[model samples]
Target: MKWVTYEAGAGERTGILDGETVRGLAPGTTLAGLLAAGALVEAGDDARRAPTEVLGTDDVRLLAPLPRPVSIRDGLCFLDHLRGCHRALGRDESLHPAWSENPGFYFANADAIVGPYDDVPVAPGSTMFDLELEVAAVVGTGGRDLDPRRAEEHIVGYTFYNDWTARDHQLRDMAQGIGMGKSKDSAITLGPALVTVDELEPFRRDGRLAFEVSASVGDRELTRGSLATMDWTFGELLAYVSRGADLTPGAVVGSGTVPGGCLLEHVDTPDLAAFTGWLQPGDVVSLRGEGLGETRQTVRPARPVIPLRDGA
Candidate 1:
């Protein structure tokens, strides 16, 4: 089942993607609301009645499947990405083996999420803006101290996530013992549709992520890795997250950068500034995965504001 939130003649409403049209589920209801009400499974199955007016897929604008999540935490689930990034930055010391013992993640701004068609706005003075190819599970059932064995039950569906990054800000923040919050602000994008967890059973592969993740900037392919490479399973991550907090409906847990997904893994900062493949205005980034669908965003650089200072 594919669920979406879209804007139509009536207004922004929740719907099911059926063929080339979006069939409305109910007015003023969103995917998040449906999840909270525990009506998603039932709502999607029974949304066949005619809408006030059916919107052709082209006539409507798709929003993030869950427009407003309670929280967003993107995790570094693939070792190849970590190694590649560190190596690109001239690091030789290997990460401690203990670092991979448990699933790890960084909390992101939930309010920063945009939809598939929205423009990705680059932060001003960002020397390197990159995209992190990811797939995220949307929470359906809320729980505390969730068992790893039962974590699957809490997942409602999956969506493609583009974790946009401002590399200049990220590295600077890290140098001062501050977090990377500024570098990751106001740019995460997701959507097109949300595919239910049941729809992905064939690709489960004994419960570890196994979907192929792909990304491209215009005509150039940047990544061709698979979720099969994840060092940690969603169950383990969820269990770890739930240890001290409650997992709630509408929360998003993201798989971090797949191998070779971002510029940070391919080029050093000085070299990247001169690289044409690094995202610039009008560059379209297309991200896709097996069964998870695709999301494309056109990059738009922040308008430059020349700094003014009084003559010394």
Candidate 2:
């Protein structure tokens, strides 16, 4: 069943879409809630209760389907793209060899997420910006030291994510061997909707998922690839990531950017001109997969204004 966190008239709440009409669920609602309340079965029992009712595809304000992810872990799993980048930049791919042992990932601030339709703010004093199209999995059960073989059991579902990067800040941080610069204010965009594991399991085998991913900026198609192209499986990532840390329900784990996934792969100039030039204000980015629905967000300049001084 498809689930979503939405804001209609009242504040943000969870709901199941029935055609063009959305039936509200409780706040802090979860997949377990739907299963416990028998809502999932009810929705499935009748063909009419499908989530297509509350809003048409165009009308829904799709928030990140999982509102309160406990933690967000993102991994670098694209070998072909990584090798291409190393070759293009004339860097040593051997230094960052494909995971011979296990998966590796970094933590992302879950609260930093924004909705699909929200305007991404291009922060002031920023000239270099880039976008990354990625696939993210939501965790359902909490576990520790999880075996790679049982990793799939912890996943709740999957969603689309755009990991926006501030190149200037990122470079500065990278020079220092850190990632803080690439991971700051409004740096992540998620949602459109969340498709449950039950709805998407047919596309997976053992613990690896296979799905086609494609992205477009305005009228130009930028990237197209498949999840099968990934070097490490989600199970490997889960097992590696959860080694000592707790993997909680609602945690999000993203598969790093795909090949030609960002302008960085296609552009050759030193200033990254061709890359940042296309994402002018008002440009719309759309991402889609076979079972997971499409997510679109428009780029807009950060609003200009300053706060008044407290005793002025």
Candidate 3:
């Protein structure tokens, strides 16, 4: 089932996407609301039988499948992403011992999520704005201290995610040995639709999602890789995140940037260095997955920053 949240005339509405048409759910029914009620699948079944309204996909505006997520935790599961980044920065490329022990992740700003087609603003004072292409899973059934073996059951669906970043801010913050709060809190793009786990059965390999994902800036493609390269699976990521904390319905977990899925990885690569650079105003970034759909956004100018320190 392909679940979607969209705007058409009245207000935000939930529905199921069947090819090019959208079959509406009960009035005012949202993906978040359905997940909280633990009736996401049931509602999809009901909509399939008797829809509130049927409209063409082009007739409405597609919003994030789970707009107001309870929380956002993006994982760093791909070994190549880490290696390539280190190689680019002229740093040691040796694997981190802790990375193999567990799937590492960090929390993101849940309130800053934007839709697939929304415009993303550049961070103020940022000259190295970037995009990280990934796939995100939305939790349907809440749980705590979940076993990695059974964690897959809690996933409701998957969607495309763009972890927009301000490289300059990220580097500065990282130097301080703290979280990447200002660097990534500006915006997160999600959407097109949330495809249920059952719908991606054919693409599953060893219980992990195996599909090609790519990113493009306008007409030129920058990065392309498969999701199968991750060292840890979503189940493992969920298990680690739920270790003493609650994994509630509507929480979003991301499969960190795929190998070569971000401009940062290509910054020092000879072949891509000439064509790729920090995102500029008017640059359109498009992230696409085999089954997860596309999330495209236009880069907008950054808002002026308020002065934190006085004096000349």
Candidate 4:
């Protein structure tokens, strides 16, 4: 079953997307609340019945499945991506042992989220703007020290994720042991629809998922890669993140950037060097994966952030 959220007169409201129509669900009940109640199955079952109201997809402006996630964790799980990046850069030993030994990830601001059809507000002073094509899983319930074997049970659904990056700030800040949250938080996208595991299980192998992810700018398809190429499975990623913390309901996790999914990984490639510069104002970007669907947005800078105090 596929779930969605969209703009309503009262504000964002939860609903189910069946074919060309969106059926509104219970009042004041957000998708997050359904997951927390461990009622996703029941909720979806009820939604299939005649809903409160039904509207065509074009009649409503779609928002992220969860407009504001409780937390966001993105991971680097693909090995081919790392190897390709190293080869392109003429470097050796780029594949560190720890990558295979343990899963690694970084925290992103949940508030960075924007709707699927909304314009992306680029962070100011971000010259190396890039987009990472990926898919994300939303947690259904809280779990601490989650067993990798059982992590799948906690996942509520999956959605397409566009992890917008300000590469300049990312590189500079991490060079000094700091995070680039200031830049990363400026742009992020999720949605189209949240497909439950049952609806997407056909794409799974063992515990890993395989999806053809593709991204395009305007009409040109610049990125294409397989999601199954990852070295770490989503189950492993969840277990690692839950080591000393909880994977709470409403929490979200990303599959990291897929191979060739972003410009940074192609930095030394001839094609990347010949590209028409970084993302500019008003460029339309589209990202799509197998069951996760697609999210397209036009680029725009978030209103200028002016500091009240002068720096030395």
Candidate 5:
């Protein structure tokens, strides 16, 4: 069942997406509640019961599918991405052979997430905006120090993620041995809908999830890669992250960026001005997976600001 958080006349509520229509759930609805409610309603069912019984399309504004996630973790699991990016930047020496052997990840602020339809604002006083197309999973059960072999059981479903980056800020922070710069603002865009594990099981073969990922800016195709290229499995990432830490339900974990994923991996003489050269106001970024639905976002300049008066 595809789930979503959306806004109607009644305000933000959880719902299921059926075709082009949306069926609203109760206010403050949650994945846990749906599970507890047992009979998860279909979007079509909700649509049939809408005020006019015709599905209120205008009332539906898609929010991030999962509203109140407990935690969000992302993994750098793609090896081909690392190699291709490093090679593109002429920095193969910085590439670590063991990156694929061990899982690398980062924590994302769950509360700060935005939906696929939301307008992404570029950072002010900055010109180096970048995008990373990724596939991320949501955890269904809470566990600690989980064994890698059984880590799949903890997953609830999958969603598309665009790990937006400010390249200039990211580089400065990386130079300082921390990742604060790359992770500011509404840097993470998640949703459209959550495709459950059962729906994605067929895509997994020999213990690895396989899916094609592609990204585009307007009519320009930016990157294309597969989830099969990852060096470490999602299980490994879950196990590693769960060590001595609680993995709670609704926690999202990303599958990192794929090859040619971002300009950082594809460009040399990395600079903000040069990286965002192709991006202009009103450029649409579309990311799609095999089964998961597509998420399209338009790029817009950051909101203008006025300078503060001295000693105000």
Candidate 6:
């Protein structure tokens, strides 16, 4: 089932997207609440048996499936993306041996998430605005030190994630040998809907979801890749994440950028100002997957950046 959270009248509501209509669940129902209660599947079944209300597509405005997830962890599962990005940065193009030893990830801004159709503002002082096409799994059960073989049972569903980035800021911050910093905290988009694991059975190949994803900037198609190309599985990634930490419900685990999923991997240099294809205000960026839904966002001007230190 495709679950969604949308705006209705003066309040928010949760529903199941069935074809062109929406089968409304109880008022104030949220994906986060359902997952935290360990009743996502039960709630879905109940809604199917008796929908409280039904509305057409034009009746409601969709929001992120879980507007404020508990936490967000983005994993680097695809080696091609890393290799391509390394070459673009004038670094070694060969795969790093450390990358093969672990399914590593970085913590992201959970408060920065937006809906599928929301307008994303370019980061202030950023000239190289870019987007990373990814797939993320939402946790349904809380666990610690989870076994990789049984981690799949903790996942509730999958959703599309557009990990928007300020390329210039990211490069500068990472150059200091620290984290990626807040370069990606400006805006991260998720949803259209949260598709349950069972719903994706048709796309499963060799026990992995093998869906193809593509992204476009307005009329021009930028890149396309497959999720099955990931070197590590979601289970292994989640297992590593829960090594000594708690993997709680409503937490999101991203599968990182797919191979060739972002413009950073395709560009030769970090000089976006000299590049004509950089995203501009009013540009529409759309991403679509074979099974997961599409995420379409419009770029907007950035807000003024505040100085962090004493006046220079």
TM-score of 4: 0.92
> Whose lDDT is greatest here?
3
Task: State TM-scores per candidate.
Answer: 0.93, 0.84, 0.95, 0.92, 0.86, 0.96
Q: Number of clashing residue pairs in every model?
A: 0, 12, 0, 0, 0, 0
Q: In candidate 2, which residue ranges exceed 4 Å CA deviation?
A: 27-60, 87-90, 93-95, 182-185, 205-207, 270-278, 303-312
TM-score of 6: 0.96
Candidate 2, 135-194: lDDT as tens digits = 888777778999988887877678887887765566677789866554344558777777
Off by over 4 Å in 5: 32-59, 97-101, 182-184, 268-278, 304-312
Scored by Cα lDDT, where does model 4 land?
0.81
Whole-model lDDT per candidate: 0.82, 0.70, 0.89, 0.81, 0.74, 0.87
TM-score of 2: 0.84
RMSD of 2: 4.3
For residues 4-123, write the lDDT of model 3, one tens digit per residue: 999999799999999899999877898898889988878988889999999999999999988899899999988889888787776788986999999999999998989999999899
Q: Tell me how far the alpha carbon of residue 64 in candidate 4 is from the true structure, in angstroms, after superposition.
A: 0.3
Instruction: Please give, for residues 35-114, the per-residue lDDT of candidate 4 as tens digits.
Output: 87888777777778858788898889999998888899998787776676666545783677778798778898888888
RMSD of each: 2.3, 4.3, 2.1, 2.3, 3.6, 1.5
lDDT of 1 at 128: 77
Error of 6 at 201 (Å): 0.9
For residue 95, model 2's alpha carbon misses the true position, in angstroms, by 4.2
Error of 3 at 111 (Å): 0.8
Estimate the lDDT of model 5. 0.74
Give the residue spans of candidate 4 off by over 4 A: 83-93, 269-276, 305-312
